[model samples]
Target: MPISLDKVQSTAPGLVDLAKTAKVSLEKRNLFGTRAKVAVVMDYSGSMTREYREGRVQRLTERILALATQLDDDGAIDFFVFDSTAAHLGEVPLDNYAGAVDRLTQGRRMGTTDYAGAFRVVRDHFGFAPPKLAGGEKKGLFGRKKKVEGAVDVALPDNLRPASEPVFAIFLTDGAPNSKPQAVQALIEVSTAPIFWKFLSIGRESFDFLQQLDDLEQRVIDNADYKPIGSIDALSDEQLIDALLDEYGEYVTEAKRLGMLA
Candidate 1:
């Protein structure tokens, strides 16, 4: 059966409350005080089959897209799916997000989960590169051009370069990562950049490894945080947003103190 876009938009349960809570959360934390970019990175491995089929992921995506519409001027979100590798699903418009989420979940499932791959894709998408990292320009795994020039720009004074918009990446997963060291390394490299990673664990799985992300050593800043949501249906929209952003308020406060985020 075909789903009408209007019906999908009008019938989404808790959407209004989700949007309201999202706005309140952002305002309370003073996050993205200016225009910011939003991205949703979903784990599409076999372990996530049940959540996808149950429509939890789709509903969550819709709510986040609603948040994006309120926080971002463009009102669109960049979407990506990861298994052994990550694939960009393009920007989903707020008005047509239901169709986009449906299409994102309608694909072959990959066997393993690779968090590093998804982070790499996002870093390249936003043209972020670490200072003093030298390598010949090559195409990104997703076919986007990886320019070494972007690294040099990172060294320039804030006044010299164009103003940057902070990026909030919402990563949803259901299990442990296949490569922990690589994932930790990627997070460390982007810590100084204007990007914040909010990782949400779906279902009742033990996310012990993910919970330790904040304890990692030798980072410019604590750039990521994790929370487990046993069931999306169990929480009110406000509660859901609060759970997802539990650590984000402190992150933003510390980021400002360190002069990392404006």
Candidate 2:
């Protein structure tokens, strides 16, 4: 079971309502009582400066933390901020998540976007092995030309490590990655594990590259979902939660069917 309602009210009174709404959202998706490790990965690139300053990042963090209170056994979400590099900001607990965005990004300088670097950090943090990249040049995440800087390697069959639970990762990015091939390869590798990636575009970008995750044939499972948020402020809590969790229940069911989770 998740954290009790009594604890939520006492520890983080502001999130009490949001947590209640999340419970209802989970019930609607038939994911009530589901237990998973929660992660929120934020893009700390130069383009995201406006959003961060406008408090949209903080708003989203609070919302995700509220949802995490219901899904994660520890009532916290592992947090990461990334750009050309990735930084593990540690866990944002239900009790101390109010100013997480500002607190974590206070002294950090925004860098160029590097989705693959951030993905690799998450993969390693969760104990997944690095995936081999096939030698080839492919369209980059921003539609730019880029080389996949590695030798061709044969894809292996699914030999994922056994785990008792799944990981729900919410990745927020405003634009395309510096290297699309690396990002794709990262997803392919983590697909074998029990981690589901939910990529949310926090800007007006189409995120065409992310949409391909549904049909990417290199993975053992469909482990990702993408949604474009034109404006974060426009969404009510319910609407935000719905978009964030879209297709997640199905992903969990499929993971169990494939023996990724017991």
TM-score of 2: 0.87
lDDT of 2 by residue, 37-139 (tens): 8899999999989998989888888888888888875878898988888878787878788777788778889998887777768878888665445343333
- Summarize candidate 1's per-residue lDDT along 30-116 as a digit string, tens digits: 753445577899998988877778888777878777676555767578988889888787887755667677786565666789888
Native-referenced Cα lDDT, model 1: 0.67
Model 2, residue 244: C-alpha shift (Å): 1.5
Counting clashing residue pairs in each candidate, in order, gives 0, 0
Error of 1 at 88 (Å): 1.6
Please name the candidate that would achieve the greatest TM-score relative to the true structure.
2
Candidate 1 stretches greater than 4 Å from native? 1-14, 30-33, 131-163, 257-259
Write down the lDDT of every candidate, Cα atoms only: 0.67, 0.77
